[model samples]
Target chain A: MSLPTHTPVWRIKNSPEDSVVLDSSDEATFALTEEPVPSLEDGEMLVENVFISNDPAQRGWIQKGVLPERLYTAPVREGDIMATHSIARVLALKDSTDQRFKVNDFVYCMTAGWRRYAVIKTDPSACLPVMVPQNVSPTAALGLFGVPGFTAYYGLHDVLKFKEGQSLIVSAAAGAVGNVVVQYAKKVLKAKKVIAIVGSEEKCQWIKGLGADVALNYKSPTFAQDLVNATSDFVDAYFDSVSGVILDQVIPRIKQYGRIAACGAISGYNKDVGKPTMGATWIEVVTNRLTIQGFVILDFMFPKDGSNRVATEAFPSIAGALERGEITLDGTEDIVEVPFVDVPKVWGRLFTGANTGKLVTKLA
Target chain B: MSLPTHTPVWRIKNSPEDSVVLDSSDEATFALTEEPVPSLEDGEMLVENVFISNDPAQRGWIQKGVLPERLYTAPVREGDIMATHSIARVLALKDSTDQRFKVNDFVYCMTAGWRRYAVIKTDPSACLPVMVPQNVSPTAALGLFGVPGFTAYYGLHDVLKFKEGQSLIVSAAAGAVGNVVVQYAKKVLKAKKVIAIVGSEEKCQWIKGLGADVALNYKSPTFAQDLVNATSDFVDAYFDSVSGVILDQVIPRIKQYGRIAACGAISGYNKDVGKPTMGATWIEVVTNRLTIQGFVILDFMFPKDGSNRVATEAFPSIAGALERGEITLDGTEDIVEVPFVDVPKVWGRLFTGANTGKLVTKLA
Candidate 1:
């Protein structure tokens, strides 16, 4: 089989001070001589990637590691591949013994890259059988049909244990995952009220279009008071995707026996700053009978077995809901395709806030 | 029926400053004069005094309504009679409707006291039946066999679910409730280690005698470090009867899934002088997977069929162990017997820190 002489990559150079600043192109980036095409050994396959995902959590992954105890995601050495999730087609296979994939078959894989092609070994931890929906483009798997969707689904339906008639307060409610949570809490769980806390006034209205019962602009100085008045003395569950000063205000008002699912800390992701200063309040968890748990979807979501079998069974209903327009993606549902060479520029634009939804690079 | 010319009562003449000072002997205290003797109605009996209990928590009750939101206990109003647990004799019963009691019976009744006689109404919430053991003194019901013992028994055995070969750490281990917890955690629960945090070196050694594996004086500068060294990374449960600077140190070091049964917050009970501070730090809780619950005995120990069930079940084993000498109360059990006239002076001495385990007044 013939191989491409040059591959592409995007590197996050010096980090920025804020989200808006970091997402923009900086003078410090570098794109040097691309490495030669590598061979696939046993248990490895060479794949031409079709689509790559850019998520808000990717900002967190760049700044933090999988676990808090880890120093960073990259290897201790300086020149290491960063982590990413991509949908790829198998170009060549080394192991005839492996039955999960065949040459030219498309598979969703989580490996390092904005690269056009890479040699990936069969990861024992990751398995792929669910194909890209025939009705939707392959890039749709990167956003609503992929990690962000699963994270939103499991967080609301499982971790928060969303009950009917309960009120759910979700920060970042206009973003990719937040939009899904708002719809899931409303349509699937029949939540009595869904209070969307968004960064902007327009985004607040945008989330309301996605079936949110109420939307509030967190940018307002009266945000905390607005939340208190909106929930009407009852906030049963809090889905916290952006934890910062907003979380500090949200915690005290949660009703008795309330649950706060700490999904992600995106508010501080772009800032490679020191740990956030803590609020000096004792939460009196018992008096309120509160349960707060931190979880990552990958960490908690098991394979289609055990307790997660229920999640697998419910996956279709969630997907069906999305497909039938019961749950809607508000912005840029179409894949924004660019040549494989523009991956870094797209990534720079991603952090700059110029792009909306998933950014995928097409390979020829 | 003849009534006494004067009756004794402990009065907080005014809310005390930083320090707690009681005046049971001040003649200027609301005088009990020219009032007709209270008559016993049906379901009620007249209890002549035997012993009255002095507890540090009494100060907390006096500062705020015992139940912050609801008046569960009979109100302890200013200029009203002070309420306390007393082992008393049923001198007379005007009506014999309540099957639980009869005239001339030695009954343990919690009454408004520091007096010779009290007309106790048979309010189930206001009083509890004390079964005096032949081997144990009537005064034991005033403390070691009363609420303090029950608190320790339920909090450790039931709430903390104390396991053998696990360590149990308790604050204020020499205090009435804490001393019982030390005995129960060590002898009854058969915990591998019991660490007691006490105020002084004297109390530390005293707690150590009551089967505490290690006792650290909380007042010591290196107390937190000493506690850390003593446990050596194995702290399964923390029975926090005292919440103070001690809790601030113990919390960060607790093992994962550790249960903190926060029974009371005695350290900050009297805030008469200083401003109220932050309640509890939330980050330590999130990082540790800690379950901190503030509860009163009433929340769990609902008696089945009018028998104090926790007492009937847990008490037997505890009492049997006490009888067999498997558990011993530290010889510092200070039993102060005062005449009917001296009740006022003894009440004044309680907050001065002169008394220790089970301060009971005997009337013979």
Candidate 2:
């Protein structure tokens, strides 16, 4: 097999913080160039990027002064190759003695970057190229079975201490992690009530179909009153993904001793993301004895013993539920395909709400 | 023993919210009047106030808008009798069948009013007159063995999930709850390092004497720089008593996965109390994966079965430590004796830092 010497890649040209707000659509902010692909060391494999995930967090990654670094992942430096999570196909192995991975095995890569081909280390170590389960679609490695899903799992179960029959609420419910959280609370936990907040009516409808008892369009003119009418005065738990205005609205309505899993601050990711945006005040937190926890999935993703936290703990249970048809994901509608070369502009669509679905660059 | 027919009492006249900030010193805000004492009912006891506890939270309970009602206790309504936690001597018992109390028994009262004499209830029900231990001075029932110490115990052990050997920081370290928190962290928990934030050098010295490894005067000109130098980049836990400027300063210096016990908002009590103060941004929370909880000692103080969470759980453990000399409290210096008629002015001193001590009304 012949190995490719040059790879097409994108790097951060201008930082997101340099802009008034994060504008991923500004092509000048991203640089597309060709770079020599370095030879892989032992335990590393050369993989072709099959599907690269374009996440809302990407806006924060290539930015500064918005969300601080080390929230979920370290922010991509000003001139660093843009970071990505992707499904990849192994093309060649670096070590002849390494039998853990065979050529053409589909794997999930954490540092895939915005490249057509990359070198990633595989199993027997806790690097990248985590083998994708063959039983599910490989694309799920970048979506439902990946970081987004794992985030939902931990936020709902571990962070929120969610219990069965409790009423739960989620913001950004149609987004990658939010949808999974809604499904898990409604279907798996059998929550008495699950309310979801989304930007558009279509997104609201989509989440409601995923078993949300009530879906509120946050962009609606009557969103605040709508939330009040929909909620039974207060909810037992709140899974907050958007932490600006919606957070403020949800704060007063959370029941006393309510648990809030602050999974993401997507709404403010383009702005100064993590300052206690308007509504997440200490008053509500104290008055109600609320427990607000901010967590990053990656913090729990890798264990020092070379075992993957998600692979070892989350994937088994969630995948089993998927196979049993107790919880379903909208595979056909929630994913958008973009050409590998249109990376920057297509990635920008995430913040613009141009498409309310997971954006992925398809290379192979 | 006979109960007094008329009791000299104080009632909220103007309400703290009537001013720009909580002005507990405004004499016009309180009205001292003589009221006919109500006859005792079944399971009730007539008690004479011995020592009334004046807490920083008193500024919160008598105000509106600054803090929402139901923070630690109900906000004192205008024209309502002033509330105080006190040490009282039982004069009479209405329930002849009740063997829990006897004349001259010293007890802790949760809802003792700012009056010379009042009617409370004792055991077999969750009314006031919680029996005080015989081993400690009855005065300790309103100070070290009372609500302030209990607040510190729960905030340290439960809310912050504080562990021995961890670095801990506390604000208002010489005040009612803060002093106990500092002592618990340093003397009881054996923390690696304990830093205290107080307003005055006098308080700084007092808290240092109590066992703080370092005490920073938040009122100092170089307070901010001093904090950065004293903290080894970050601390493991912060017991935040004053949640305005001091809280903002401490947030960035807390270590990864640090816990914050939001005990009180004394600094902002006179301001817009519970909104996101300047420093507690979600950025710090998310990046650190922080668990910030706001709690009231009262919530746990009462059980549906009528047992006190504090008396049952916290007192036995802490009082035993005190008796064993594992920890010591300042008896002479930290308690300020206030006259009964000076309730409004004395309570205001709590906010002004006029006296860095637990203010108590010695009615007897």
Candidate 3:
């Protein structure tokens, strides 16, 4: 099928240093442009994005600096479209015999960059463009069953080997991934106590309702003491999102043989050489025999072994729980769903702690 | 049983700031003294040291500042007897009915300090003074089956969860623990390739005999490039003993899902605040989804759960392996067995790289 002549998109247009943390207002940093859409080929389908995800890792995918072949997902080069894991619709399927996809089917498009409409492959070997399972909103599909939620799932279940009745404390607890981790730890994993650290008091209250035993604002004067007080019995596991002072604060508070799933260092991503202010303390790690595991969601989703546990494990667990009404995305109540034009601006809000939970944008 | 009125001993005489990295020459840092021996109580035994183990962690046990009531062994404080894990002869047992220890038995005495003779407990609740398994020399028992060897056992088996046929790399390959790790990985774990990094060509040659596929002298000018070339398939596990610039060099060379057994930071032990030259790089840790675990030998020896895997698992395995003569301690060939008086001098050699393999002093 013939595609549209042109489609609007965003491409990085700055030096590698400034490529981190997108700011749409700065045209030099990120340029909004139009590119002619190429006609679809066999085994390919045209997908129109309905909702797109914004993650803190984009700050590390500095244009021109990110590796060309990162096993699963390659970072976009300068002048190329910025990538996002999005919920898109199969607007047009090029192959009549394609068993993987159908026209008008809602799909989880893995490589759906910033463009409004793009061609995505639906071959057997392709990792994304899977049908978004039945009866879930685009928000739930992208936010709950997407990268953010799956990251929480694997980081807890696999990395931490989280056990029931074990206490868990998470930093950036109001974020998309962090919120899901907090809820999953308390509701599904049956954590004895869940300590959620957020940036503001408002976010604090919001996360507390999502099964957090104690929601402490990291900005408070007594935050450190509050964390200490809350951890009467040192935590069994920690889910780290902001890795500067917050991670340093949590490290010493963990008990012996405790686990830390280092997911994101959002606070350090835009720094010089992408280094956090304080290096993760090694003393506590050694003295307490802590296990610090760092992970990216894509690894589990499209694993080299072809396990695809994200497809087989996380998606089913989250969807089943949602279906059984076991757990709700209560923390997503204040989600900042922006329009396609405001993707750049809302992304900036992530750094400023302006957004509450999963911050996505409506593309169509 | 009657014991000697006094026993010659060594004690920490310096301030806590100067406690790291032992320097016996500095009389102010470590001083020879004598402690009065008391009559043995019930379940107590008088033991005379045969061989005493010297470790880099003694530097961090600086006199006066170590925390008391640590879960396992407590660090020596200023003016107290400096402790050592020694093979001590059970000179006198207070209880003839004691099942854990008997007089004349060469026991693995956990709390035997740097002294000619001392008293240790043998109760069921007591953690140490374990009867050394028969059929091994003092060096073979302490260096090959003691803390150092068992450290390699659990670090690879538990922390790294290492598997056969996967590649492995280790630093300080000629040291007491590292030598065992190199041999065990190739001879026991059946690793496809084993890379052993050491300080000198002489030590490198020695480790090669211990089943290392490739032994690289880290001090060579082309060490970095040499390491890169050696990791053709990228290593699956890294057992770290020296955590300075060497650890930074090894992190990026690891494959995805690499496991790091953070055993020792000997290079940083005497540094300011016990910090290494370089904080472990976090970028590669996160990108590659690595798991870095730190552990202390005592934790496994006398675990909170009372599993005592060190006794139940490591000792038996090492003893059985020795019985079968499957592997040998070739790296401990250049042993420096100093007298009790020369300990102060040899202990300082650990930092200058003047000594090889295990550094122990004969004390009777």
Best-matching candidate per DockQ: 2
- Candidate 1 CAPRI classification by DockQ: incorrect
Which of candidates 2 and 3 is the stronger one according to TM-score? 2
User: Per-residue alpha-carbon lDDT of model 1 for A1-364, expressed as tens digits?
Assistant: 6766556655545432344232334534323236667866888887777776666555544442223432123321213354467788888888658798888887777773666778877764433644445666666667677766777787787778888888889987766677778888898788888998887777677778887888998779888789778866668889886665677677666676678776665655544421342331222333454566655565444543446542564467677887777876547343557776656555554433344334555554
Best by TM-score: 2
Chain B TM-score of all predictions, in order?
Answer: 0.84, 0.88, 0.88
Would you list the clashing residue pairs of candidate 1? A23-A351, A23-A352, A24-A352, A282-B280
Candidate 1 matches the true fold with a TM-score of 0.70
Please provide, for model 3 over B1-364, each residue's C-alpha lDDT reduced to its tens digit, 9 standing for 90 to 100.
Answer: 6657888888777755533434555646678876788788887888888777777766656534544422235677777777666778888877556676777877776677777888777754332444445744755666777778889898889888888999999998888888888877888888999999998998888888888999999889999999989996789999997765687789877888789998876665555423322222455677777888989877776687878787788878876766666567544734566667666666767766666777776652
Compute the lDDT of residue A298 as modeled in candidate 3. Answer: 73
Worst 10 residues of 2 chain B by lDDT: B272-281
TM-scores for all predictions: 0.70, 0.84, 0.82
Error of 3 at B277 (Å): 8.1
By TM-score, is 1 or 2 better? Answer: 2
